[model samples]
Structure formats: C-alpha cells, structure tokens
Target chain A: MPAEPARRPTLDRVLRIDQATYDAIVEHARRDHPVEACGMVAGPLGSDRPVRLIEMVNAAGSPTFYEYDSTDLLRLYRELDDRDEEPVVIYHSHTATEAYPSVTDINLASEPGAHYVLVSTQEHGNNAGPVEFRSYRIIDGVVTEEEVTIAAAVDTNDAAEEHS
Target chain B: MAIEVRIPTILRTYTGGEKAVNADSAGAGTLSALIDSLEANHPGIKDRLIDGEDLRRFVNIYINDEDVRFIGSLEAALSDGDQVVILPAVAGGAR
Candidate 1:
C-alpha cells in the first residue's frame, strides 16, 4: 500500500464576496495608489459573506503604510456593534508590490475572524488594467492564502436577513 | 467603582471569550488604575495592552467617545458608567 499523503483535507477556505463590493475595493485601491487604501466589509456575526464595504482613510498617508484614523476606527466599531455585525473582511492595497501580505501586515493582523484582502495596483496606477486581488487568513503570525470567489449574489446566513 | 471594559476579539481569550467585563474594583480614578485592576483578574492581558508604561502603539483604547491618547493616555480619568473600548488599530504596510 502506498503511504498516505501527509496532507490535510482541502476545506472550503474561500471568500465569497459580491461583485459591487469587489469593484469598490479595486476602485479604492486605484484611487489611493502610491498611498495605501484600507477598509472593511462588515456582515452579520458568523456570516463569512462580506456584504458591506467601508473605505477608510489611511492615517499614515504613506506610500507603503496604512492605518485607519483612530477616531474613525472607534466609530466603525460602534456602528458594527449597533448592527450586530463584524468585520468579515479587512482589506488594503500595495502600490508597488504584489497582492500579498507584507511582514508588517502579518504582524499587525489582529482580526483573526476577518478575511485579509490585498489589492495591488503596481501594474496600472489609477488606470484600467489587470490588478492582482487576493485574500488570506493571518492569525498568530501565520499566513494562509485563500481563494476569492466573486459572487453575483451573496447568500449570508439567516442572521443576515434579520438586519435586512 | 465599576468600569466596563470592552475587549476586542483578539484579546477575548484573556477575557474568557467575554466581549465586555466590568472592572468593579478598578478604583474609578484613572485608566492606569483600571488596567492594574484588570491585570489582577486576567493574567498576561496587561502585557498585550501595555508595553512598558505606555500603551502599545497599535492598540487603541477609547474612554467613552474620547481616545485615551488625547485625554491623558494611561493617566486618563475614568468614572462610573464610562464605556471603555479597546480596539487594536486596523493597520499594515507594503514594506
């Protein structure tokens, strides 16, 4: 008998995001090229679907760094709490690199429950061209790349209906 | 003198998965005192929230609607019924 392959079963580690939201993220990244753009997509707690996209200002305003304005961060959490939602997706962009998490990104990833999305505009800055969009799970200093599915319609769990 | 401290998702483990916990004996005086009181109950959490004497640069703490950094940092005043929210900064970089 052949030795069993030392591999874990391929579970469905995918990010099912909507087309409009996806476009918005790309657009935001393009607009903030050279200066990183960051945002969040909030959804009902436990719902893996990213339904709402909220663009945030990069307080650092640096070409290679991004940080949500401190005041805005607080308000965003309050809004999420009011709607019984969570940051299902936390996204940012890279101006001159590929769509991948940098060392700083991995170290600063605090939301283990969120899908970390990275959009790279290095190919075409603020213009129409192929952009690299990717997603990952960064938890406890570990990075696991995941597949991103652009769904025309997202079907969140039952909890999503309560708010809608 | 109870101060309700809201724990972010990352720090929930120290809080036993609690979203919010009341620091009853936190001496309704200053933010630093409240943290000490919390440390007494939840071991190893203070280290995550505070680096040496100052708050970790990436960790954000808001007392009511005001950020602790603007108020007075560790010495920020606290009172009953003030909602203390602790949120790690949503930040990263390309380099």
Candidate 2:
C-alpha cells in the first residue's frame, strides 16, 4: 500500500459573533473603555462552530492604555490546551475607535497564526452595537482579510461549570 | 465615484468629519501615491500613518489586516471591496 500524503493545515477563523457574544464583548469593552479589552476564542476538537469567546480578561488599561496582559494570555493558552480545544482566534475591542489596527496594535501584531478580530465600539455607550467585527491575518507585519467561519453557539459553559 | 477610502479614528480628525472619503486617481497605484492622494484630500492622515522614513514602525495597514509591510509595502494591489484597517502598537495586560 502506498503511504498517504500529510494533510495541509488550514488557518482557523476568527469567527463572527452572535447576539450573545456581541453583547458579552460590547459590555466588556464598555465597562473598560479608554483601556483595551482582551479574550480568547476556543472550540472543541475539530469543531466547525467557529471560534467563541469562552473567557475574557479585563482591567487592561494601565495609564490610559488597554494592554493584553502576557500572564493572562499564557493562562488562557494553557487552559485551552488542557481542554483539548484549539485556540483558533484572538480578539480585542477598539473602544472609541474603528475596526482598523492602531499604531500600537500594529506594533504588537507579533503572533504567528490565529485570526485577529477587532470589535470597534461606539465612542461611549453600553448597549451600543459594535460598529464592526472584522478579521485579519498578520504575518511579518503584512495584514490581509481572511474568510472567518462563524459558529452559532459553541458554549463551554457546561465545561466551565463542571471544572469550577 | 472613483473609490471610497475610509480613515480610522486616529486618522479621522485629519480628514475632518469625513470618515469615508472618495479618491480621484490615475492607473498609477502605489502605496506612496495612494497616500499622497489621501493627504491631498485629508491633509494630515499620511503624516500620522507614515513618517519621513517609512510607514511608522508602529502603524500596520491591512489591505484587510494582512500587513502591507510584509506584502509590498505601499504597492499592494487595491480591489473594489477591499477594506483597509490601521491599528497602533496596542500591547499590554492586567497590572
């Protein structure tokens, strides 16, 4: 029998958010604007539900800048590994801004893979819907929009409850 | 209409009330020219996004977030539906 060829790896989608997640992220950004909001998007093994924000990290604003804490990022990555789920997408909110990357955001686009999603929010408002949820792939500082596969409700709440 | 170009928040005040603006052009398309046209219309956006040296080391432009620097700098091709997003070096965490 002939040996089979290895499958090519596909890039994970950043996911399109539903009303629930839209609410969760917007609320998170509103509660902590002027600063930045951070979180991880995860899914079950080989899931097609797209990437979902299973958890969030707040209090990112230090001296008027919302920075994704490296420690929090490490913790999230570790949790995803433990769950046997893949970390497909990484998202952040641009409070008082647009879906475009900022001067600071550009400098930090160092992660090799993983779709980067930006939720540009209203200058000020809690219930304000996101101005836009756009996706990007930044490799060596060049960015291009990739097709994001959005899953409806990939809930890890059950797992969270069980683990908690 | 030629093509509508949208400026990000940080670059908006430069455009003056015009978040999305139209660009008049020739077939000559280069990152440098596109920016010159934008600067002509918006006045100060190019300066903020670029410095005299190169695109500000901090600013990243996505011909949809793919990073123009790695692709072709300012020479990246432009399509009708293409959306360009610019973000600063927003790096941080909880403290």
Candidate 3:
C-alpha cells in the first residue's frame, strides 16, 4: 500500500484578521493614546473570523485603565445578539506597557472564546513608529499567546449571505 | 414569578450550557433574592456572581437594560418577565 501523506495542521491558535480592521485598530489606539483604547470586533456566531470593528469609549478615561461604558456595553451586546454574532476579538491598548495581558486583564477576562488583542502605544505614543501588537487567549486565568496573521482580506466563505 | 436570567458564555458551564435560565422570583423582588434562587437551581453559580454580599467588581448585571448599579445594586427590584442579563465587565489597563 502507498504511504499516506501527513495531514496539515490547522491554525486554530492563530488570529486571522483583515488588513483594514488591523489598521483601524492601530489607528484607534493611536488616537486614544495615554488613555487606553478599547473595542470589540464581532463576527457571526461560532465563526472565528472578526469582520466588524466597533470602537468603544473608555469610560474610565484614565491613562492607566480602560473600560467600556456600561450603557454602550449593553447596547453593543444586544446589537450583536440581534445580528446573530459574537465578539470574536476584544481588543484594548496599553499606553505605557508592552502588548501583553496585565494581571487585571487576565482576572477580568470573561470571554473565553475571544481573541484578546493588545496594542501597546508605549514606544510611539501615537507617532508613526512601530507599536507592539499581540494576541492571546485568556481562559480560566491562564494566558496563552497566539500567532497573528494579518491578511489583506479575511476569508468570508463561511459568512452568512443575508441578514434580517 | 419567572425571571429570565441571561448567562454569559463563560459562565454557561454552571447553567448546563443554557444561554438563558429561569429563576424563581416569587419572593421579595430583589436582585439578591433572584441570585439566591438561581444558586439553588444551579449550584456554585452565586459565588461567581456575588462576593461578600455585593456583585463581583468585574461582574455587570442589568435588569431590563438598566444597570443594576444605577437601580440599587443587589437591592434592585425585579418583576415577572423582567430580563436579567449578567456580563463581566470588558475592562483592563496598561497597569
């Protein structure tokens, strides 16, 4: 019998985001530098792809902390539910730290299925320099760093065709 | 009274994978009482929802789209068919 070919490994741990969303997230971080920007990218329920980016206001409005406005949070979730979508990526910025999950981030992580993307504006402070962009899966207080693949266009083959 | 409690994805394990569950609301119409009734049906869930008589700092609970904090925290009143949604605050920082 002929030898069977080895199966290719799936890139489940990698976050495959689109170029436009990526640029927008970086822009948001820069625009709100020193106050910590926050937002969510939502996609179809059960689909790992992040197709929509919704920038959120940092209710804390502080240099060291960021929180989505409570009213906005509820409205966002309701909107997602109405669209039959889920938060595929919950992203935030770190003004003075590296692109990594802080202790508070790990403790407050409630969405185990989301890709926690952290953008650090420390090096540039909204300037035209490189910023650290990283992704992680924080579940049950454990942080697992993941690969991030920024594609010119994310695959939308599995997306629903129509919305009511 | 039947109060619908919406559970966030991470806490669905305590609810046997139910997106929403029914909790008894026949007694005093307080959020605390609703949580206690929920804990009775789903063991080990109140701890995640409450801490030492207050809602956990990171946990956000809303009644009929109104934040519990504005309504009265644990003392927030409830009525039959009032939607109770619980979501952990999406928050963090550079520190």
What's each prediction's clash count?
0, 31, 0
* lDDT for each residue of candidate 3 in A42-148, tens digit (9 for 90 to 100): 99887788999999999999888889888999999999999888999999999998887888888888899999999999999978788888898888887777889
TM-score of 1: 0.93
RMSD of each: 4.3, 18.4, 6.2
lDDT for each of the candidates? Answer: 0.89, 0.57, 0.89
lDDT of 2 by residue, A23-108 (tens): 66667666656556776566654552334675465544442245443344444544655776654556677766566555555546
Number of the candidate with higher TM-score, 1 or 2: 1
Per-residue alpha-carbon lDDT of candidate 3 for residues B1-95, written as tens digits (9 for 90 to 100): 89999999989999999999999865899999999999999999999989997998888999999999999999999998899999889998866
Best by DockQ: 1
- Runs in model 3 deviating more than 4 A are A1-12, A157-164
For model 3, chain A alone compared with the true chain A gives a TM-score of 0.89
Better of 1 and 2 by lDDT: 1
lDDT of 2 by residue, B1-95 (tens): 15456554445667675657766434555556667777887776788778785887556665554567777877776665555555443353222
TM-score for chain B of all predictions: 0.94, 0.74, 0.96
Query: Going through the candidates in order, what fraction of the true interface contacts does each contain?
Result: 0.90, 0.19, 0.77
Off by over 4 Å in 2: A1-18, A45-54, A58-64, A147-164, B1-95
